[model samples]
Target chain A: MGRVVVEVMPKPEILDPQGKAVVGALPRLGFTQFVGVRQGKRFELEVEGDVTPEILAAARQAAETMLSNPIIEDVVNVFEAEVSA
Target chain B: MGRVVVEVMPKPEILDPQGKAVVGALPRLGFTQFVGVRQGKRFELEVEGDVTPEILAAARQAAETMLSNPIIEDVVNVFEAEVSA
Candidate 1:
């Protein structure tokens, strides 16, 4: 199976409460080396055949339309993943 | 500033309902070249300094202990990302 990985994140201008909570808790966990944190979603998709530009384009569309809310989120990256059985 | 991206995914043995729902809806949306899909979480952390192995290790621990439930989820990969301002 071919694969593609799409990342959906809150747009840079948006506030991420979950991310802030995690960042706040990090210091309590004795981790103070971090300056900030943002959490997002990843979709690892198994395509029907070899991953090509066409497949990636379709995947990007799927991500934009199905996986993310374009108003509040951004599709950060699309990666051709190594698919193994 | 340095950065580390940690991806957390449900274990292979686990079931992913959200991914299934998206995959199920794909064909209805007129795109059906996919076999399966798995959804996961991505953490983008901005560290105080450059991302080194030590920083990666700390991030891994943060992911394993704080970000993910190791019993049901797995931390897949850790990448060093370019921190642009």
Candidate 2:
């Protein structure tokens, strides 16, 4: 089978409280080397057969419409992968 | 300067109710072609300067310990990126 990965992330200008929380907590845990942290979501779609180029397009479309709010979010990537079971 | 992306996904054997819910909702929205759906988290770390190998290791360590529950989740990728902002 094939899989498609859609990574949805907040727009750079948007405020990400969850991400900010992680960034804030990191310093207390002695991970103070980072400048910023942005948290996002990843969706893996498993298709029954081989993934066509068209499937990638459809997956991106679905992700934009269903998985992410385009007004404040964006899809970072939509890529296909080969998988078994 | 540089960025690191950490993808944390649930173990294959784990039951992800959130992912299942999305899968169930898809069919109702006329997206019944998929077999399964898995959801995960993505962490983007923005560093000040160049991303050395040591930076990658530290980011991975931080991600494993604080960003994810390693017992039930797996890090799929920890790769560096080039970014302007």
Which regions in candidate 1 have their CA more than 4 angstroms from the true location?
A: none
lDDT of 1 by residue, B1-85 (tens): 8889989988889999988988898899987877799999998999876888888888989998999999989998888987654
Q: Write the per-residue lDDT of candidate 2 for residues B1-85, one digit (tens) a residue.
A: 7898889999899998879988888877777667789999999998888888999999989988998998999888899975856
Looking at candidate 2 chain B, the ten consecutive residues that score lowest on lDDT are B26-35
lDDT of 1 by residue, A1-85 (tens): 7899999989888999989999999989977878899999999989876998988998999989988999999999888998654
Deviation in angstroms for A67 in model 1? 1.1
lDDT of 1 at A76: 90
* TM-score against native, each model: 0.94, 0.95
Task: Give residue B36's error in model 1 in angstroms.
Answer: 0.8
Error of 1 at A72 (Å): 1.0
Local distance difference test scores for all models? 0.89, 0.88
Per prediction, the TM-score for chain B is: 0.91, 0.93
